[model samples]
Target: MIVISSGSNHANAQTSMNTWAGATAQRVAYSTSRLQNRPDSAVTRDVRSALWRTPNLDASGIRVRARLGTVTLTGWVPERRQISLAGHAARSVRGVRSVSNQLLSRNSR
Candidate 1:
């Protein structure tokens, strides 16, 4: 009777493992479909590029990262206003959901 109980427990464990694996696979597929449906990623890239090329704003030292419709501006700029400008520029983008201005001011040379 003990041996039979052990076998049942093993079977239950295997079943649980299989369920977990199926759940994981479903999650992966869902994530992939969601990502494929995301339309803002391309817009974010375009916005970053436009910001980088905007006149009067020095984008050389700035770094831009975007995820899930949010754009994060990092690195350094020469003036405080540049940080705001970067944020504004990012916001002007068509698909930008939000902008996080993390730009640091650099001392003048």
Candidate 2:
């Protein structure tokens, strides 16, 4: 009969497990960054459309920046109401966690 002992083989198994864990951590980090950056692209398009149709907003000058799940709306609109409206519209989009209203009045332009 042949028996396997736990010294060398156990060491090798532990090392392999550590290596796999390190690789998994690296992959998770990469995936997280990709997910963070993805919102920037997706929200830009939605912001454009929502701003265009919002009666209170001046869509032409509006810009949106997204990081992680946060959105910031910038540039000028004709009315104060537009600023609130812009933030509301951004918040309504899927994956938006928060919004910063940086919209300025048209007179400020």
Candidate 3:
């Protein structure tokens, strides 16, 4: 029987474990991103519905997009307050992680 060095073996094993851990972390991040993005369309629809349901807010010219639970509102609103209203409505929807309001008041143009 031959005796092997324990220190060398431990170092090599540790290196392998570290590599595996890094790969696993990357995979977990990727999976989480996909899960977050999976409901984007539903988020968009819900935001649009919220805007429509808001009083004095005309959603006809508004467009909504969602990614990773982040909602983006683009387009125009009739009144300046409507911009904030649209943003608030979008934020009120469930699953919305954040809101980017790009809406411009038609009166501002």
RMSD of 2: 6.8
Residue 51 shift from truth in candidate 3, angstroms: 0.6
TM-score of 2: 0.58
TM-score preference between candidates 1 and 3, better one: 3
lDDT by residue for model 3 (52-101), tens: 99998999999999988889899999888899989999999989989999
Off by over 4 Å in 1: 1-41
lDDT of 2: 0.77
C-alpha lDDT of residue 92 in model 2: 82
Best candidate per lDDT, number?
3
Candidate 3, lDDT over the whole model = 0.88
Clashing pairs in 1: none
> Whose TM-score is greatest here?
3
Q: How many backbone collisions does model 2 have?
A: 0
TM-score of each: 0.59, 0.58, 0.64
Residue 37 lDDT (model 2)? 41
**Candidate 2 C-alpha error for residue 84, in Å:** 0.7
Q: Choose 2 or 3, whichever is better by lDDT.
A: 3
Model 1: weakest 10-residue lDDT segment is 1-10
